[model samples]
Target: MRGLFLLTLALMVPGGVQATLPPPPGGPTPAPRLVSFAPPPSVVVCKGGEARVVESAPIHARIWQPWIPPVIGRAAHQIPPPPAPPTADIYTFSIDADGAVIDLSRPMAPTMWPGDEQAAALAKWRFAPGAPIKGCRLDLAPTTVALS
Candidate 1:
């Protein structure tokens, strides 16, 4: 009978039987998958101001004080003195760690238009690498007094 049907087709041809085939119902045997290459946190602009890296640190003031002169005054106030009342200018500083300008002071009160060019443009401000605000107060944008 054709040599017993070629020995039952060589034992039904499927060699290893798919290695005992039994892992398809998803039950147990899946614990070998861990991959992490690192290097994914970098937003450093801390040479005077600018930083970002929230979940992994380095979240300092990213570019503090770009144009804080809503109106400092004296663009043209020549020969019109005597009627002063409105005033504001409280510049204080302390930003180090790369963003320079440390321990700057400016407790304004008596104005005749002389902030030394706004303290020399905040001493060439620059910021980054934060968390070191010892007395950082630069409030000079509040002049809406019309109580008449």
Candidate 2:
């Protein structure tokens, strides 16, 4: 009887059945899920004019974040998507005499915006005048539909 029961149990179990199950319904797809992130303050302070500040940030083209579907978007898109991911922005910030963030600038390229949201969000930024920026705090938050 014991031998018979053991055989029955072995037959019931599927051969090589993967123990791990797929993602739950309405869950994120297992895609490449590309995410690019730069630690806060890529470029610190530069003692030149405004032009110098812009030069400090890596002025190049590179993907910042990869967007996924809504369910997986937030999870995969943890980093802030560049106006144009994979493309570096001509980023610059200025502080007033009081060390408050006064002027913040990010030049837009053709790739920056697929829609109007990017332009609008970038324009609305207001930094404290003369804000003593110890590092490059570009787009302090994620640029998304909700935040933008």
Model 1 — which ten-residue stretch has the worst lDDT?
57-66
Superposed model 1: Cα runs more than 4 Å off: 1-47, 50-82, 86-92, 97-104, 107-139
Per-residue C-alpha lDDT of model 2 across residues 32-147, encoded as one tens digit per residue: 32233243342344354231132122222223344434442344446333233333434455544444444555544335334234333433433334535433334432222221
Per-residue lDDT over 66-122 for candidate 1, one digit per residue giving the tens place of the 0 to 100 score: 122222333333323333333455667776656555777887743434456556666
Best by lDDT: 1
RMSD of each: 28.1, 13.5
**What TM-score does each of the candidates earn?**
0.23, 0.29
Clash tally, candidates in order: 7, 21
